[model samples]
Target: MSCASEQTSKNPMYTISKVTQSQLTDKDIFDEELDKEITDYDIQEAAYYAQKGFRVPLKSSIILAQSGAQVPDAYMQAALSNYYNVSVYNGFSKNKSSSNRRKDKEQQVNNNYMKLLRLIAAKGGQNTIIVYWGTIEKGDLDDKTNIVKWSQYEGGKLSSKTKALRYLLKFTLVDVTTGNWSSYSPVNIEIDYVPPKIGSSITDALQIDELMKKSYDNAALLLSEKYKDKTK
Candidate 1:
């Protein structure tokens, strides 16, 4: 009689080598460093693509109030063109009363005057438009108590108490395609003016024309700074 015995395979058993704690930690650090490098390379590539060709050449139209109480045509056109770097056109006209009436009716219904302006700009082949208006009112001094004061002028001439006048200039820029718009009003300008004495024929007390031009220039400069990306 023979006893039965278990037999082992002739091939050696597969064994995994022991990994120390230090070895495992080093491998994790190497993997983290590799991931960081890949992430940095992706960011650099994205930035390079964005800076290649983003802005396109555009043309703009400028529309002033119909009352002809805005900035001079020549100055407004030149200032905006230089600051915004776009071809500027005058979209104001005195003979568009019929069209104006129709637009007014539509504005009453839709309450979107900006959309009307965009339509006008689109007709003129303008990608953008600038519309501006201004108002003048009496202003008080810093103390807010007195609106008039005796101030000395050039040559130390003392005149009667002069009143202060505040000028507010409001302007808006609209994108014809998107109908997106921005409005701005630069800080108002206050000037002391000696009103013409009763029965005096002198009418130019505050030089309203010059003040209007100054306000328009300030508005253009502000717009240029705020929308610098639109430049060319």
Candidate 2:
């Protein structure tokens, strides 16, 4: 019986275990690739509308959704209210579960986004929705150099050797009427100073608030350029 058991173990089912481990390791990369593809598709769809000279009506109200770590609604409203009637929708919250299959996860996100759009339409009679989110990444020495150059261009000063953090603000505009959407990253803010040695939490909060304001302002300008309102 012992010999027979040893022989069976030699041909044990390692393939299933190995395949599962491989998948676990590659899940993140797979999700990132799929996200990039989805973003590209959104941009292409927006471009198609642009080619056809589509313009969002200035009079129609636009609903806003902030995916994570809520940036104050006032920031976006202040940035874009001048161009269009805009309001922030606080009813939607993101689903934050990790998934083994990225495509299914992507589909779930899309469904949630569309559901929010429909909700806004039903509740407020709004036909357009703009969803925004942000990500923070540690920056390298090379990024510091670029920050210094940008500061110099803007007549501001930044230390070339200071550690930096990159803040990426990504946003999308969807016209619910046609289910047409466009996405953009109008500005990437790299800051040399964050989490001050004293009062780190408060200071970090303030810094993020300021950066969010700047990002939204920049995005508003870009959106205005890309989706020009038809002149009456």
Candidate 3:
């Protein structure tokens, strides 16, 4: 409830700033950095709440967004801070004939997906959620339909019909090593179903803090509803 700095240093993974809540909430001094800090807290708390009853690997779930040999540290850090499992792999793509570039790209994607599948199997199937970094066709699970693309929540534009304040986490569950994937679901943190405020549009950062606050509240509510029975 507060952002004030505390003297608790023995426990690691502490990112909450030591500044007082008043200092953090002062609008006059508010900056983009503060906005990000608050948003991160919300995300972490929401993710933490969501994982309460469900079985998840805190550090074994791998997020491979692309074919890159190395995933940036920022992504990994975000995953860790948000209580997500973190694992990764790299594979080589063969050169393709110009006529079949599309086919080759598809093949590369499939290969990466398969490699991830094998990794999940080897990891003992810790109920991993593969957070892929690409878009999936609607209701199309057979093709590359898992692991959300960057366009979903990331600066990407949303359709008018889907215009509402939400925090989305795209994931596909692999409960077992079946050498196939289940359907990917975008977890929309629906908060009260309120219309978007005119002051803040999703694309713009005019009211980013307010938007994130609403999102956090909604996510917490949804997670609570999901695990209510388990908690009891």
Q: In terms of lDDT, which candidate is strongest? A: 2
For each candidate in the order shown, give its overall lDDT on alpha carbons.
0.43, 0.51, 0.33
Give the TM-scores of the predictions, in the order they appear: 0.46, 0.53, 0.31
Candidate 2, pairs of clashing residues:
none
Candidate 2, 104-129: lDDT as tens digits: 65433333435545565657777777
Error of 1 at 168 (Å): 0.3
Q: How do the residues 1-232 of candidate 1 rate in per-residue lDDT, one tens digit apiece?
A: 0011212121111000111111111121111233234678766765665455232233333443211222223444555655543443222322211323564574222323345556665776656655554454543243566545433121221234445545566665555665445666778666555556668764333244355456557766776676555544
Instruction: Score candidate 2 by TM-score against the native.
Output: 0.53
- What tens digits encode model 3's per-residue C-alpha lDDT throughout 1-232? 1111212232111111211111111111111233234668766765665554343344344333222222312322233334444444321232221333574563322223444445544665344433322221111112355432223333333333332344443333333343223333335433222334567553323233344444334433443343234433
Model 2 worst lDDT run, 10 consecutive residues = 1-10
Pairs that clash in candidate 1? none
Q: Judging by lDDT, tell me the better candidate of 1 and 2.
A: 2
Off by over 4 Å in 1: 1-75, 84-113, 140-162, 195-206, 230-232
Q: What is the number of residue pairs that collide in model 1?
A: 0
| Arranged by lDDT, best first | 2, 1, 3
